[model samples]
Target: MTTLSLHWPAYRLFPYERLLAIAEAIALLSSRQIAEDPESVTVTADRPAAAPRLTYFSAYQTPRTPPAPTVQHLIESETSGGSRRQSTRYSVHGLHEYKGKFNPQTARALLNAAGLPKHALVLDPFCGSGTTLIECAHSGFRAVGTDINPLAITIANAKAQALRCDPELLVAEAEAAFRAAGRSRRGRLLADVRGAYLHRWFDAPMLARLETLRAHIVERDPSVSEILLVIVSNLLREFSLQEPDDLRIRRRKSPPSERDPYQAFLEDTRALAANVRVVQRHTGVCNATSVRAHQGDMRTFATAAAARGMISNFDAAITSPPYAMALPYIDTQRLSLVWLGLVDPGTLPSLQAELIGSREFNGSPRSIWERKLVDNSERLPAAHAALCQRLLEMLGEQDGFRRQAVPSLLYRYLAGMRDSFLSVRSLLRPGAPFFLIVGHNHTVLGGHRIDMDTPALLSTLGETAGFVTERREPLQTYQRYGLHQKNAICREELLTLRAV
Candidate 1:
């Protein structure tokens, strides 16, 4: 039998922090070759030579079943760097650009290490951009994901549905839809348009084209229309009058020169269609795994699931919750949300307030420091407790919005996290594994350095919710250089916990 093994640089192995995928890849490659008893592959994470080795050591009888055409194609696709690029095929995943989305490779690697049986149910409560769910589906595991944001759910559903679509049909329909949109001159400003925001980010002619595209998309079948909307949404930020800066929504100083919207849509659709076709060919064996996505708050998902008899049966779960105030997800995709009419401009404040790690707070002033906040603070780990204390102390040192918001935001964020963890715990079967890929943030409060040790804090909190911390693997290390450099070296960590 052919053996496949390699060593990788430490830097490239960050985030997922596991060598299990190497063995999984080998099993996939050698699936049809083994006879009688199916031997397992040994994945070692040791620096045996110059670099860390992802050794897939296995001994097995060969030539049981011939390699299928799809298997041959997939095996041929594996190159020296195939391990890194295999999970993220740049197909349906390229449909939208989401800030703080975890790598699909990480999800796949986690699944490989999870040791769950095929067609097992996996849960991702905070399934931003649906990376974990999509990976689980591709790996032949049924997956269910939930998100509070409707737009995110829409994007995830469209991506999952791409697996069932005919690539040639996708290309043809996308082309016809855009062409028909371009030919229509009845592009008037819709009533739901956030006029000020749209005017600021897009020129009139470009906006007209998008409006026309939206009009045409809505008239099609719901599934087709949803996919087209995702494609259209992806184009907004690409051609927006905004700098290709960081994830946070920011505008450019001047308007950009206009490009043909139809051409851009046509090009993006064709490329995505081709990628989907390739992905379909490679993932034929995983078509049995069911994928379900829901648009709702994760904090209350457990209750909803239990009510609907969808609880406690999940074998595994994986997710990366939003970093503490590091990314404003809703605001980041404001352009798409506004254009798609998914979120109204006036209701943004309420929606933002509902999100965990949100800086916005609309609660009563007295309620901010109530008994509930104190109880939430009590559940925090020691490090988190210190952070909370320091943040609370900062309130006395400052005046105005910063003073009013910081303490409330910190308490609310912690409370929300506690609720989410408890909810997730309820949904997992006893001894089931839950993988969390998360990063921490640093803040200055009361002239003290407060580090939000996310993974460490989460470990402590998981214990309170009947979960035992199994492993804590550090992934990438980031050194801080600016003002808060003293207490600012944060490493993204993969935390594995088991439900009790």
Candidate 2:
């Protein structure tokens, strides 16, 4: 193999770059451990001392701290092949388990590679669960995140709030909430609430107790109450009849654990408070409260931003869009929705219809076909245009429900994604990088399964939206996590683009 020495944005390429079959004598180097001569001055008199450089998976970010791991070390870790296991119990990240959330390591790596100046602002258009926003804030960059899901916005906001508070104060607030929850008496407060699934999942007494706790928490100011409520929300799955691994609401023969739900809530609250302390020790506290998480549509973010008087000159962004026709995000988080009283059973169907990757048919089936044929064809790269045509052709041969709904699902997702790119382009400064970490979903058409290459397709569409396709790198976590899953996710891609 041939190796070439060069300098470029380091984080744009992933470990998968090494696997690419580039021409001989033109191999890409992934190393960031530059050789230094003691006599030669890398630091100059004119410039201030360089900021601390981060190493792979190293969370401690102080001057006296040990040096960071090299880019080679990170690549080795990613390529080492297995379930990419890293501790998620850091700082505010473990406050609540967000389904399909990408790891924090990946987010930090992307931010470092974006080559943004210090104190610059970053945007996450599809900031599911706020992983990117937390990373940006942790790295000392201002962050703004927008999501269509209010649950996600709440989770992100709560996590950010938790990260900012003093650990002792946070713990004290949690303890106070726990005490209030225990003291609150239950009655017919939720007697009129109607839901068959709630009854099936939770015993009436237990559900009543939970409702009492939720009422007490929600009655308080949302600042501390949200965190306490999230703690309760986290305990719901374990307390209920559902299995831990899968999102489906199947009844188990026995409880997953023998712990009492209230005790578990108290314990989790303390654990989360402790994680805040650890996070503070590793990454210094974000003094500026610059994180603004909006529960809004990505396609209409421009209007949302303008209304909020938000700045448009964003430097970089990192986000992972939901896979096409994949997980039912709103349905999966129903327990949280119900516990938080965000919606009742009646409102669920309408809320689920608003989700981007929903598989349910809520509108005309023909509109889906029309969208795929018309909207997707504009700004079509030759190859992508051919792929879209092929997918549409496959749609024509489909039978049953798949024939009626699949095209619409594909069109809805792609159109939202394309519009999201255009929205981000308007917010980003020219040449600012947009890093999208996305995985493809499998769609069956004509009784045959096909891998929808979402990264390449989105890159083509992004180019059409006037962005430069900078790089596409595979993520190891998807390979590891998707191993046992029955989905068509072969790998996740770090698809990078620069707003032109």
Candidate 3:
């Protein structure tokens, strides 16, 4: 006769949010029966148990007592409207702004639903900004993440390190670095290509301030320097000539002043440090050594991990893979990438084209990808290959290059995902669960709008790559603001598969 009551957000805006909350409770608590109400879910178990570790529940109670707030509840309460849009940005997760990162709360809920043992190893092959990794660390799980974007690797590792390092020490070091950068004259300007690229994007005074900051950050200890670098990297778009709202490399009509960089750095550092402190108070120190991030292709990460003697077999895998014709990830973060010295300015185009689901391909590389798709069409699922052929046939002579290239781009994207699925399967224990959060997208070609049901296609590919498709759940996405809102995907799907 033990009753555990789980209370979630009163404004459960999305249907999937409610479903995930219930699923997490059921899986974590091993409850016998679940009764639902408008505000809470009451679970009855055969025996009394410790308070269940949860994600979506704001609080839980037993024997009709007052509800106890969860760690997630406390963290979200620190920011306005955090229970909704800001949930993913809490803690060091907000240290840098990264586009297309899935909600950390959703990742947590999925982890809870997986019913993994304490400290179980998890993998995120496309870690993006470490949303899955950070959530794993907070829940006492060991996680390894990989991303092709160098800036993503830097941001992810910095966020994980921030959780392990002393918050006060980090803040003090950041203050000292800022002061030193302000006092120091523009040290050595970045020479040659990188310097030339910076000159084109930033006014002279602002570029000097940024260079000075970079020099001071480079002078600090590696651990401290990484955290400081993320803070400065976040300020790049605002201070640069690039338009902050657009995902593409559009120029800003008005550029920020020289003083704006310093002010932004100080404010961001303080705010981030405060968030880190709050997170530490709630979750305590996460083991820094438990989390690892690599800058490489996901399709080859398994082979690399095996070569490095890293743990190859993981208990579970969770990731939100990039959508077809995905956003210009490199173009949006090129300023940060160049300023952080993560990549060369000259190689930006090739690097962008190399990303899975990238839309930047052209010339010989495009031809090579199309040839590969034709040669290896059998590697993809029948339905997927058929869709590519249909799209190709639908293209008209009047269509532009971007429209005509869709079929080849999609074929290449699916082929890449198939390889990634195989890689993840190699790293996961048999019967381990793999969860992917993906959105559906569409494009108009030849006066016809064709919807790309990416979730279903990836699921079919996953099955072909040694997995069992369990289910696909529809998730209603929140309203997006800004210039990209009109282009945003209105819905997403949560596809659950089990490695075989």
Candidate 4:
């Protein structure tokens, strides 16, 4: 018999997290009789095995003092007590702040619960900022991530590369790049259209400094340059005229106070490098080459990956998919996208519209989607189709265009998700688990609030797309702290499905 105790943080976790922590322990330990106490879980088995690597539990049987705190733990502890779920400050996950990224601890726990073998290939089709991929690498699994957003791809790849590269080499190169950027003289601004567009957001001095930093970054060793670029990109919003707190693009009422780009870059780079060192100490040097991030639509990524000779049969998949009428992802990152030369400014609208669950449709595209919904062309599930129809029926003539577009937008979101499910299922081996952490949302139509059960809807879509719905466990969502609190999701669910 073996009794494995959970870490202190596990006892304080939300209800769903506690459930997942126990499931992960049971799977990893292969226990016969599981007993849960206030502080620990005891499992009886024929014989005890070596201490299991766990996400939410200490591997030792007896309570022992926690290991000495590392730089990452110290930094994270200052903000959120370094709890497992709140410990994003560790590793390259803190390289940049990405909106809507899932908790890395949850990803690690899910991976543990899946009980995948070492070196098993995992897939995250909607890999925003590579949370799952980072956890996969930490767990010694090879990972492939695909996202339609180019900026996401860049950040995700940068994070994975940080885990693989020599920590000292990265720090040295970053310091050299910062020095070069600081030394370069500010030159005359370009007279091109791109320059004119950028001028709207950034004053001349900051823009020139950013451009210099970018140039020096490109000049550095290609292997580590991406990490440096991400550092600069994370600073863009703070320096720009855009309101840093708002999710959408809105100019500040008054220009931001003068800020030091050099100081900010130095601080961010040093902190990121320190966290990278801490990650290396724990996970050793992961093979960055084994972690790949592809920029493409999730609905079509499987086909593209297969054509490129990438592995198609993954052991498992996990993702936190965007909500219906999701946040304006591209709009929020437009400045970074243009400054990084990832996409042309004019194409932002089209790219935004391309994202699944995007609320950016207009003109012909909007009309086409509406027509399809009217005709039921996508063969949506009965409940999903009925819900959309009900929402449409509730809309009155007094409703705004955004309200009028609700039903069609919901239709498009579900259809896209259905396609995404098909695509993801095509890449998984038969019977592989696919987990989605999705939030429930609500919308107002004709002054009536209509709740959208997104997790249940997606489960139905998954069933139609060659998956068997396994479980849908309710998860308690964390509270939002700032301007976005009013728009927070009150409830989320973990939907588990098995590819058939």
Top model by lDDT, which number? 3
Q: Please identify model 1 stretches exceeding 4 Å from their true place.
A: 1-89, 193-197, 244-246, 254-258, 285-289, 364-367, 370-387, 394-400, 477-490
Q: What number of backbone clashes does candidate 3 have, counting pairs of residues 3 or more apart or in separate chains?
A: 0
Q: Write the per-residue lDDT of candidate 2 for residues 1-500, one digit (tens) a residue.
A: 11112222222223443222111001112222222232211111111122223323221112334434333233333333332444444557777888888777667656665656878899998887888888777778899999887788888888888888776765676666567878877522455554455776777777877776776666665557777887788788777766755666566666457887767877887777666665566566765377868888888888778788979999987888878887676776787877676677677877776676767656545565556555654444556545555666776443676555666566666766778888889999999988888886676777778888899889988998879999887654324332443333337887889999
Tens-place lDDT digits, model 4, residues 380-496: 987888888888789987899888989999999999999999999999999899999999889999998888889989999999999999999888655522333334344789999
Please provide, for model 1 over 291-312, each residue's C-alpha lDDT reduced to its tens digit, 9 standing for 90 to 100: 8689888888899888988756
Q: Give the Å error, residue 22, model 1.
A: 5.9
User: Which residue pairs collide in model 1, if any?
Assistant: none
Evaluated at residue 125, the lDDT of candidate 1 is 85
Model 2 global lDDT (CA atoms, 0 to 1): 0.66
Clashes, model 2: 3
Every candidate's lDDT: 0.66, 0.66, 0.82, 0.80
> Regarding TM-score, does 2 or 3 come out ahead?
3
Tens-digit lDDT track for model 3 on 6-81? 7866444356777887777777777754688777788885433534467787788898678888778787777544
Every candidate's CA RMSD: 6.7, 7.1, 3.0, 3.5
Write down the lDDT that model 1 would get: 0.66
Worst lDDT 10-window in candidate 4: 66-75
lDDT of 1 at 227: 78
Name the Cα RMSD for model 4. 3.5
Clashing pairs in 3: none
